[model samples]
Target: MAAYGYFLSCEEFSPSQLLEQARMAEQAGFEALAISDHFHPWNDEQGQSAFVWSMIGALSQVTSLPVTTLVTCPTVRLHPAINAQAAATSAVLTDGRFRFGIGTGEALNEHILGDAWPEASQRMDMLEEAVQVIRELLTGEQVTHHGPHYTVQNARIYTLPEQPVPIYVSGFGPQAAALAGRIGDGFVTMTPDADLIGRFRSAGGGGKPVIGGLKVCWDTDRDRAVKTVHRLWPNEQLPGELAQVLPTPRHFEQAAELVTEEMVRKATTCGDDPDEHITAVRAYTDAGFDEVYVNQIGADQRQFFDFYRTRVLPDLPRSR
Candidate 1:
């Protein structure tokens, strides 16, 4: 059975807009929520990046739906212990409704401190160690660690939820999928790829939840929607490790010039067609994802919610 959720993209929307979307998502029958964590926007036009922890605190007061960080990077930009503290407090505020989703992260956000970015292999090692540090601290015990990537001397997180927060690990490759399976409470990935999910299950993620998400545009004019996506999310089509290595929004913008509108049209579902939106969601449900989150890429979110609430959402089976 797959549960549908809404993705609140912090990279694109302001804090106030995200809050409104959270409220609307619940009103539209979304079962849960997932928010992205980024210190910088993918590009300037996407134009906003609020502190995820602060936004999570505010979200608790406004929405009863469970919230998860679509993925935060605890290995860099911030220490795992500090992230653990934030996650602990968020879990408390949400009354045990918080799930901490994390990943190895990209250089675009993690390199801002001028720390030499580690290659993917080393980053994965750091992430695995970070996950251990976060898990230990969430137990409300004093933690003293001297690891290769991080260290904590007598650190403790006092506030926590009644139940331990579930840590979902994000992956886009086979190695990452295996690591997530071996170490994560759950798995997170963007696509509805059954092969990737199969690898995770074989590596020990069988009974654990697998979460996924995508972005779409909803407008009466399909060409306008395509143009909106091309303008705001051209980076989505950048191939290979370009997304992982690009150092800044400017680099992203420059690289994104290679992404074409037709590419976006083929890759994204646009316009106000409920059937198109329904098919996009079914791709994930038909795969083995336990939950799927969807994001409306540009403005016109109110209409997107109304369309889903009245047509698309209700028509899709809640459980697959």
Candidate 2:
């Protein structure tokens, strides 16, 4: 069955705003909540980046819906042992409703720690090792490891859930997708690419859930919304390694100069009507996602939720 959910821009909102959004999302019948875990926003203009672990703690108390980090990098910013403890505590606090979603991550976030960012193959290798370390720590037993990528000594998670939390891995390419299939309990990705999911399952992810997300702007003025998205999120259009090599927001701003507002509008749904949002989400469903999460851009949070609840949600193809 396909589940519908909301993806909160955790790096773009204050902790208080996120708490309120979580409450409202639950009230609006969202089945799950996904939060972005970034060390920094792509651009300084976005204005917020709270530590996601703390935000998840607050979210657990404020809503009944299940929560997952849309994607977090286990390889950088935090050590796998520490990540395991954080996930364990979050699972307990949320009563086992938290899923730990991990990935190799972007340079924009990981580079802040001053660690040398590795090549894609090396990052994937490190990700696999990190996952193993995290899983061991989550077992609530003392763990020690000296892997090629990370070293751990006598680490244990004291506040684990009765059951281990599911791990969802995000994969952008074929190799990473196969790894996700082999190691992850579930799969997470941004684009509506069923071929990638098929690759995942074929690689051994049988019966595992696949989650996808998309960005949209709901507003009365379509053109204005598109312009706003381009202005604020222009980095989305940049392809490949530029996103990784760029060191600062100013670098992103310079690259963004090449992206047009038309590109943003064509890539995302932007309009007042609920059907537009439905159409955009349907693309993911049709592409074979088990869960399709939508992220509504802009500040009119109430209007966005109300429109989805009243008009968009009913039009979606229900899960069998």
Per-model TM-score versus the true fold? 0.99, 0.97
Q: Give the TM-score of candidate 1.
A: 0.99
Q: For residues 30-142, could you state the per-residue lDDT of candidate 2 as single tens digits?
A: 88999999888888767788899999999989998889998999888899888998999999999999999999888888999788988889999999999999999888899
Model 2, CA-based lDDT: 0.87
The stretch of ten residues in a row with the least summed lDDT in candidate 2 is: 241-250
lDDT of 1 by residue, 1-320 (tens): 67999999999999999999999999999999999999999999999999999999999999999999989999989999999999999999999999999999999999999999999999999999999999999999999999999999999888878898999999999999999999999999998999999999999998999998999999999999999999999999999988889999999999999899999999999998889999999999899888999999999999999999998988888863
Best by lDDT: 1
Candidate 1 deviant stretches above 4 angstroms: none
CA lDDT, every model vs. true structure: 0.94, 0.87
What candidate 2 gets wrong by more than 4 Å, as runs, is none
